[model samples]
Target: MKNLDLKKHYIFFIGEELPQPEAHLVQSTNAANAAANLGYSTVLVYLQKGLKAIKPANLARPFQPRETPTELVKYYNLHDKLKVVPLPMPWPIDNFRSKFTDSNTIASKYYLPFHILPTTKLVHSRNWNFVKAAIKNGVPAIYEHHHHEDKPFELEIVNNPLLQIAVTVVDSIRETMIANGMPEDKVIRLHNGFNRLFMQRQPEKAAEWRQKLLSNERSYLVVYAGALQQFKGIDVLIDVAIKMPNVQFVCAGGKPPEVEHYQQLTKEKQVQNITFLGYVLHHELASLLQAADILAHPHCSGKAATFTSPLKLFDYFASGTPIVATEIPSLIEFKDTRAIAAWCEPDNSHKFAECLKQVLETHPRKIEGYSDSIEFVKQFSWENRAAKILSYVEESLRPLLIT
Candidate 1:
């Protein structure tokens, strides 16, 4: 490619096409960042992969690796100004060998053997090569990681003299990468921000969803929106549901069979007032947040759940609702230790229930107490986050600036 002007920046994302919250944050923020800076253009290059297992296959099937990139191109409406580069690397095999491979046999394998490679080779090949080219030509590129532990071995690629990585959350990951011999300077942590749309609370939309939950049910609603999995500690939440029959626990987001089984347990346990609305669209999330009195995330297990920050928290804060979270390192940002959110034991149902009750009795949706988070959130706004990212890109491209 030609060497474009050094002032502009580009972001290269290597992951599944499913529009996860973090991806939305990156895309929205970068665009806002570009718009704020005036002359700069931010390009989002999405590499194609199968729908993530967490989301239902029915929804995932249509947007296979080959088809999804086009949707993003059209979705963003980024035909003329924005560039969408689609690189279809075979699963498992794509993990091990780079596109610049010597043998066709190895390349044909596509999927990389997980246990052997530990790291995905194809990611390094296509993702790294893209970053390397951009960096060489004085353009700053971001290799984003939506989830943690998915790329612990990405240390090699992130630390490579060629690319820059934008990782979410900074709890244990910062230490983990440094211990793995990655330079502290190489990894940049961009805490996921709330969608710009959420900044302006759409009360009418909120009211519509509010009616859906409160109609013929209960007034006080407690919502948990995210993955339905063991690591999410939804089982503990179910147990809490059994204890608090009055509080309607509305479970939303993608659910696997095991998560569905948790729902069964709620029924088996005979816990009433727990409703599950399987996957929800992005627009609906805000209304749901507005309708709820609390945003509960009882995730207790997995590196992805524990160390990685929940993008939902940003929305929760944006919603102006009080939050109740399990004690996790990544959630330290929201933790006041003494006050604010009601924190409980990781997987203890009794403690979770107690915390929920305490929060309900105490924090009654007052905007003043949560002002810090609201103000903190101002920093995490898409425009501000983008500007910060733009600064990083400019800094990265500083040495190559041919004055």
Candidate 2:
């Protein structure tokens, strides 16, 4: 193991085991990679407990050091500059708790503050406990909030003088934090972004995927590329698929169990047009979105639906494909924007199907008022997102340094 410099920026997340197909992991890794590329020495620290228990193949070579940048690059499409550090929970306790509780909670709250925070120059994380710990231990911290959760300690933590910034993905979240007694100036809203290197117009690759997915009968391909949870509107997508038998539908993400369950549901319903291509790699996603005639974001109405920022939305925009999405609060801003091709009420499968059909039929011919999508999505690249956030952090720290 190489000695880590305390001057480097440390981004910590008590995440799931490595290389898992999860959105949060994607966001954190991309931020770290971008920060490193921007010439900041950055290290991404995540928990790797339960790997031996969950993935038996790891037992062949037990508890090796952190995965190399090469391995991470292959798995995450990361650049070579970023450093990844995986921390393991205590041995016997981890084995016992792995069955009953989330190891992330224990490790983040108890282990990380004492072992990792003291060595970090600046800490950035999504975990509330980890961020709180960093501030408590006298390290400058940044908290990135993604969801609308009721945390009792949130107000105290965000208001702490040691905390440099609180970043939210939507304006509503920043508003909520301010209403709950957080300092107005300390919080800012910045949306998620897409990987520009991969998520661009790839005409030749798009044609290849179109050749494979489309047939003589089914000329159009509609895609939904995200988690296959009920709240994510997979059920609504299934209902829409039932209504539109002529349009070929494909889902590009989900865990194995979720994929199996959805597959059975579609089978029971006797729906023949929809297929689940579970857990497509990040780099391959752009070509898949490019291959689509229309992209679907059928999120159902819920607490998560109100404030959630779906990473797939940006990726869909980057592909330059027309988008059909539910008019949830978080996504409503894009309704009038050129990014979305069509919009419908949340969880209304009939309306969703009708909207998708209208877009599919009218596309390849401009959709009247909407501008060019590729040009519209140019500002939402991952590098640009990271640069903006880091600039904010630097500005906030400048006065302290001057004194």
Candidate 3:
């Protein structure tokens, strides 16, 4: 615990060690990869609880020269500077009440409970039990958090305050951190950025997904891509689709079960124009967005909507298409909304439909203000976001880092 080995930059992440596209997987991967690529000795410690339902990388078979990128763990081996330490629990733990033996009690320290999910019980990450060990020796730390259902570990941060910096998305979360005992200057608001992997498009991509999703390259499609959870306002989107019978409405991201639920809703409601394409990869998703006339963000007012910045917004901005989003807290954070999205009040199906119709009819490409978003979105790239965090980290670690 005396002189620290500052050679390796350690980031302790408490979550299931799943492949890309899992809840925190993409963001964490981007952060670590960015740090590694930027010439830092990066190590990500993934804390995994041995829940039977949790699945590790499924297609991660023995390597093949001609194997698809998705088949293998792409983040591994590619980055020389980055290392991953996965701590998997021996026993299964579904909730806080689950009995833990002496050997497996460490799992409790890495688990963060979600009050929204009935299965997840009251539990905060046992940072005092594990994360303290990393910092006790003077290894500087960064805690990146988004809005969670319940943050039991906020108390830990309030009590210990060992984190060098805390990166957050929403203003409310940042305020909460300061109120909960994290220093005001220590908390940084870093909104979600358009992923570089998705933004980098293929030459033939523009032509492929346009025809594939809409069946017509020239169709004026209004697209919404993200989860199909209740707070996402997918039902409101279906309502808008019903009103605008002529225009095509397409939704691209959802789990199989969630997609099926919406499909059933559409069928029961006799909605025909709206199409639900379940879970398209980013490469294909980028193309689909580029071809669309307008991008829709039908976010309802809720906990998820309040303190978290959705990644889809940046994707929508990068697409060069006009955005129509519900007037949620995140969208308004920019202050200047004229150039970005056609903002409307939440749960207003009539208003949303009318706004979409107007935007579609106006032919947003020709409009003067619509192109402003393209310029504004230049700053919202993953590389830029990662660089910002890295800049902060470097400054914070400079005094502590030893050669």
Candidate 4:
């Protein structure tokens, strides 16, 4: 957050708690923390009510838990640079009884009065109505748009004169917005970034976890670290594991039920050499990636795969280890026209497994375009992403904030 103009950056996220385990919540925290690191005064306002407001949990401060805790932690700051405000439900109505179309109509009225500074600009990544509400209230703001496949960008959102900019995570999403009538200049395409933890030294516990995953220390290991969703092609990963018995496959994500579901599938297939260490925490995942021989991301095509910038892929990149991923634009971009990853079109299990084997067996000297990817990944750092968003606001939306 250095060399930037001095201004408070209001980041509104319509959620609760410090680390809720959802990708969006974690990223929102990252974005705000990065903004504060970039030298901006950042305020992270959680609009949800009924917060417990406990002391910041020091238990595994750096690691993000895989599941939300039953405990209540209403307030916590990020590095003491970002102020956190968890506003209890503003209305007497319970969430169960509330007729909320969106957070904007329900919560925007509360934002102005209790907001950090009335004059500051805002960057919101929650619901569209919140951004729309902010714009309606004359608060200069940009909406961070995640992927949406159901319908094209609505005419009202794209054509809104008050809506100055939209920050999307992938180029495909930016194109979608443009096709839906957003001006090319008004869209910012910032890819998801790896948490800095991945780039750090491997934890001392790596050897223990490695041995736990592989009884035979000599066996090769590949890991998939993301949620277990049907579209994610977890089934493909299972098939690959079944085909390759010598190579150990470890999956680290998903709820207990999801893990049990996969466990049952593995049993039916009689899969060997694969372990599901369900829901590894964020810090735990870094060492897990480092301990592995390869990072395998086998997500086949779908709307989720099409528009998402998977945080795990970048986590894999930061591991500086090899990756063998399904053919997808997002992963291919990480390849950066190089052989940094074994990018293969795996319409079937055999093809995907073959690609993995090729990556594992190929002579080290034969792989091409490896250096470019490592270089390409450096710019996608969360700090840089945050700085860019803040810089854009300072230059483009500052005047609009004069309300």
Candidate 5:
């Protein structure tokens, strides 16, 4: 922290551990990697202690001297230029803390902002507490919100003079923030993006995956990739698989426990056509997607459905495969829904199966309007998203720099 020139450095603060299966970790690490690739002197700061304390194996191993750990680089496919700094948690308090007074919260809220304030030109983070702390200390900060829930003391935080911007992943979130008195000019809606690497199609690799995934009986493959949560409509996907006995349905993302639970659920329901591939690497996702005949986005309706932006949706677009998705508010707002996907009603397995059947029967294996989807997704690349956000920040801070 000593020799850093503030003007040359940009800090991205995250409260979670890297190399996790969560979408947030994927989004944050990729954004930082994109910023670094754009030639910003970027540093990604995360906690050494996550929601839980470091494991015994991690304790036994010596600390990594490199700026970015090897595991993280392989896991997230991060750029070498991006620096990673893990802030240590408070000693005894972290070792022993109650749920109400958690150490991760303490470090993120109180320690991280002060630690990076003097070292960085601008702070970008999804953690509201970290952003609030940075803004309170007069450091320029950009806060990105993904969820629909309102933060405590939201108005006070948004109105801070040093708060450079507030970014939301969907229009509903932006509208909600504005309805709560956040300045219209200070808030922007930017969707989560797909990695640029996804655009590079690996035909041989995709063929290999198709060979491995497809069977003699089931000539067509329908794939869904992302968290295997109930809200994400994995249950509905199962029902769809049950209805379509001859088509192979594969899910390509989930933790081990989640995979086990769903596998058990399938067994109980006697659903034979479905398979779950737990936690595929980010780099391999593109090839896996290309192997699919059709990609499914079956998110259910509820509070989460209103504001959630599925990262996989962008990747699916990039895959050049036809998409079968539910007609949720978030998907409807994209304007290109009809252009990129075949829509069905949320939480309705019968309708979803009928929609998939229509797509399968109509297209064979190739996608309709494939060129349009590819062209449309060009603007939603990770590099473009990062550049747009960074440019806005620089433009907003120009007057401050002039003075």
Candidate 6:
């Protein structure tokens, strides 16, 4: 096969601040890495969604601090071809275009492209200007969907000629775009990838980490990580704790005021063995996932949940742990029972309990399944993602320029 090499210019649209040290931010950073590996020059511009202004101590770290520094610009060398740009001011439409066209050798650079309205809660007036300018510049704009609210905005932005890609993890999100009249060919369905440092860690190390979290007392440990929102089905988890006094349940995420109040429900229900570790760094999160016997993703939604692809799903797979999640179409794509995570109804406490019980009862099966999942997930590695993205980049750039 002929290798098509071109120094194609890529502008990664991060609606939020860069170097915020969050998983979503890291995923965007890695996308830049993937771009560079394909022999393209990638520029990641952070729109500064108030994350840069927050002082380090004032903000909570998401995972254990590793190579990603807690500073405003967290940089790593995915490849020599990558460069990250962080804008301290609001998304400056004029400044972005001028820089991209004049300074950067790419097509006239424009503001970081993004959109949201009254329906998509993510939109701010400041960012709307940037989105408009990118459309006007004829830049290849891409919108990433981290939540369900982004669905409508993704549709709206597709109207612009600059709309080249819509990256979403949830399988059902495609319907949302179709409902809003977007062609299927315009979008890309790329799920998130784990950092090599976390994905390739030794199993023995994982076992050791698991031991530290559970100690010798608990026979089984169940972990649920994310914000303690109502849609998260955290109450169902608490109910499980009450039903099964013998099992230890651990909840990891940021402690919201409502969640703090929800702790009262846990106490009232007399679920004492539950441990709450507020948001941890990604590395620390891996250790927590390693420690758990199974991961519980009890997100429940009659409407909003359909369009979301939680980052934790792939993270759980990367950890090589069995998952008991709600039957979201986003998860249906991975249906291998051996490596496949369990699915149950989110609000149905009995169903959730039974799913967990099955995992516990079939202890050997669970172990074998986890082992298989670890192997299966190897194909979904960052290296593989880099390869797939390069394929698209090569195809896109070949006719215009060739090496």
Best by TM-score: 5
> Which structure among the candidates has the greatest lDDT?
5
Pick out the ten consecutive residues of candidate 6 with the lowest summed lDDT.
116-125
Point out the worst 10-residue segment of candidate 2 by lDDT: 394-403
Name the runs in model 6 displaced over 4 angstroms.
1-9, 18-26, 36-39, 47-82, 90-132, 146-162, 202-212, 215-217, 255-264, 364-369, 386-403
TM-score of 3: 0.76
For candidate 5, write residues 50-78 as lDDT tens digits: 53345554344312223788888777767
Which of 4 and 5 is ahead in lDDT?
5
Candidate 5, residue 46: Cα displacement in angstroms equals 1.1
**lDDT of all predictions:** 0.55, 0.74, 0.60, 0.64, 0.77, 0.57
**What does candidate 3's lDDT look like per residue over 1-403, in tens digits?**
2223323343435455545344355566655555555555444445444552244441132111122133213532123444554544444343545446432344333321111111111111223443443344334456676764333444544344445566888888887767666677787998877655444444366656556656442366788988877788898999988898777889987778888999999999999888888877665677677767788988788766776566778777766777888888876776475545567788879999988878876655422224566667778766577667656654535322212
After superposition, which runs of candidate 1 have C-alpha atoms over 4 Å from their true positions?
1-9, 19-39, 47-140, 145-168, 215-217, 255-259, 301-306, 337-339, 365-372, 394-403
Give the per-residue lDDT of model 6 (tens digit) for 1-403. Answer: 2222222345554556444435565666766555555554445555333545243542232111122234432232244445554443423332466643232222113223221110111111113334445555444445555454343454456675555545566666655655656667765677776554445545565567556555456668889877777777888788877776677888877545655777777778667877776655565666667667778988776775776556666667777777888876666566655665567866888888888889877643232236666776677666576556445432543212111
Is 2 or 3 the stronger prediction by lDDT?
2
User: Candidate 5 at 78: error in angstroms?
Assistant: 2.3
List candidate 3 stretches off by more than 4 Å.
1-6, 12-14, 20-23, 45-133, 148-161, 201-203, 215-218, 335-338, 364-371, 394-403
Question: What TM-scores do the predictions have?
Answer: 0.69, 0.85, 0.76, 0.80, 0.88, 0.71
For model 2, the superposed segments whose C-alpha errors exceed 4 Å read 1-6, 50-71, 97-119, 154-156, 179-181, 365-371, 394-403
lDDT of 1 at 12: 30
Model 4 gets an lDDT of: 0.64
In terms of lDDT, model 1 sits at 0.55
Estimate the TM-score for candidate 2: 0.85
Which order, best to worst by lDDT? 5, 2, 4, 3, 6, 1
Instruction: Give each model's clash number.
Output: 12, 0, 1, 6, 0, 9
Model 4 misses residue 269 by how many Å? Answer: 2.2
